[model samples]
Target: MAGAIAGTAILKNLSPSKGLKTITLTINNDCNLKCPHCYLQYGKESFLVGELTINSIFNSDFEHLAIVGKEPFVNKSSIALLEKMVEKCYLKNKSVSVITNGIGLTNLNPSVANYLDYIDVSFDGGKGTYHLYRKGSFDKIIDSIYNIQSKSNVTFNALHTLSTGTINNIDDMMSVRRFADFKIIMFSPYLNTLHDGKNDVSIVQLEEILKRLSQSTDFVETKESLLLMDIYHTEQEGVSTETLKELMSFYQLDSKIKLIEKDPLNYGIIRVTYDDYVLTPYESIHPKNYTKSPYLASGVNLNQVFETMQNAFS
Candidate 1:
């Protein structure tokens, strides 16, 4: 929650000609750590997906691109994808980002570093738990964060996934302080996942925790965290009017925070795998679900795909 970037825009109201606001590419599905909650467990989906060509991503119209995957930095092919996105997507007036574990950022290619707008790094614990869950050197990740921030112009973001175990340890926040100019966004575990984590903290509980974390560090952008936390809640609960109003009233948040999650699939956010499988609305659809539907294609047309999903969900 320690972000200085502007509040997120409601991507659902995109202009068709301008293309989607953001598309998340799992540039590489191979991860360094095999965490329990990872979504790469669908063997059937991988079996059906085809190769993603450079032209396919470069030609796609989107305002922002999030370069993600098993470990985007570690993947050789992802490095190629990043260079292409920087050359193509950045030149076309699109913003590009990468959500990483903060391990390999210090050694990023100059071309890749030059075009990046944001870098979201993950860390669940401050010093102790950070070592346990992620299985990386805490000192090393922090060094990477510091090195990246010092060497690049990109904004920094800290992403934490909360559960019954790590939520209570607030001291780990000090680890985030190393990224002096960073923002923070904590995530809640979801149901029906490749890894169904234990009981998730409720909307009320998350609100309280976010409020507390906001006060914990100046690095945390409390209001933005509040907005995202609320968005997460709305998405999980189907955005009911009663749940929304009550939660908004509790935090005194404006109604516009409701904008982000309303129609995420059509929100112009597509997640393409290394093999070119389009996973729109990363939150709602699982990687394997594409196998269950005809959505798995050699190449996808977003407008047509959006229309199909909208009609089905509507």
Candidate 2:
């Protein structure tokens, strides 16, 4: 809870009025992987699309940046954009991170490797679990991580989708630890609204798994503490509704979890799609009813736009 407050406080200080720090910008919706849990709903046709420019990002005031997907590397221009951002951030002393499928690493580009401060590669369940949802080239993803590590200064971490089928294999996660410095994150399947009610994973089940995982592995970065905090503080107005409150309480969350303030500026994720600037508290775009604001601004004044964001957050 203290770190949560510290994170939020730093975000507020960055742009106190706007309270923005972490910016999640999507270059495009295109991704090579067809992970079943992917919320983007992307396919082959989508991969052909491209991303926004690094020049566009330089105009914003974000201190911490997460270049996310649909697999960011699928686009030919992704490396170019990344290089530009990295050089700019490095010169400005800013921190940048990338979230990828790891397929792009087979012939890793040096520019990307040099610029990133941290890289998170998705590795849900060894090769079998990866192939189940992410389809094709599992070996390539593993190889890509090795390739990036050999060539870059960036820190690499493995990200896994925690599902009923994948959760039991803690050994698979431990296997990845030998190859590189990695951290396992439990994937929350409930965020996917596409799932029919019958097959959905319950809050209780998620809690149990978190409890087990917390006790069992140091390889897995414990995010259960964060979830517990979410259960409490995230229930207030503007964060969650009365129904959500009942649900959190019903799960007996008050005893197990601690709540933290929902820092609109610092803590949540923000995305830039073709249509608008998107913001969500979590990864799933649907459950939160993605908030969009037009990217179109009349005046060329960057300061004016920053002022506008400040007013909106205030």
Candidate 3:
């Protein structure tokens, strides 16, 4: 089978723990809620990635994979794809991870959670602040966390997007650590591509809150994570984003990027969109009209796509 051959090629070169790692894929474009901040070019009815895309993504010289976009748990096909990723990861001792809104996570099939290394649940904030943007019960989100933890040892990370609406959510969101077995609570800045004047939260104000959090608990992430979040939300509003290149130098991610330059086969960002196979640095949750993807995402030999990425980024 094509997938088997691809997995074999990945096994041949990747050590997972030591060799190359990190492959991100948008499994499907179907989600239950319509958040005001959603920027994906496709909508809920968009098609999911096919078998060739799955094999091509895993076959690359990568060890870890990040599942994003819509909600992968909306159907069984997404679960099937995740299971395949997990199985391959287990064989190579690699890792597969996903970022979900936590609605379907409540009754998430045990087989899927067993193979994942990380599960990031996006909880905007506690009940009141949570419902402002996301639809669904905060209780259900918490239940989803318990449901998965009861079944697997996967590290649970709470992903809260800091926006104008949830500026005061720090207190309630961090409280997740008190009740749940969350390994990390990552509060990242929200990028307002629509510029609809709704998510006009201040960066300086956020930094101050982060400072407060640092003094409050050990659950807060390192300075690197904060910087990474800032970098992710930074916009290209005519100010040259080249300074982002310097900001990236402050983190361990810098090391992984160095490997990408040294050997595209070993390390580099591979992003799978509904219509294209993209490489990061050039990828973003930017509005479709303002996208800056460096290459097209396809289902064919994604490994070879790295050569083109290396030439551009490296």
Q: Which of the two candidates, 1 or 2, achieves a greater TM-score against the reference?
A: 1
lDDT of 1: 0.53
Residue 161, candidate 2: C-alpha displacement in angstroms: 2.4
- Scored against the true structure, residue 195 in model 2 reaches a CA lDDT of 19
Least well predicted 10-residue stretch by lDDT in candidate 1: 1-10
After TM-score superposition, what is the CA distance of residue 272 in candidate 2 from its true location, in Å? 2.1
Cα shift from native, residue 62, model 2 (Å): 1.2
* Tens digits of lDDT, candidate 1, 192-243: 3322222233223544544444445432434333234334444554656566
Off by over 4 Å in 3: 1-20, 41-44, 194-267, 287-300
lDDT of all predictions? 0.53, 0.49, 0.54
TM-score result, candidate 3: 0.72
TM-score of each: 0.74, 0.67, 0.72
What tens-digit string does per-residue lDDT give for candidate 3 at 1-314?
00101111222233322233566667787887765555554533757777666666656676567677557777777766667767887787777777788887765667668887777777767665677667677877887788778878776777665555565666676666655776555655555453212332433333343444444333243321221232333332222244434534432233212111122233344466655546442343443532355455444566666656555554
Which candidate's TM-score is highest?
A: 1
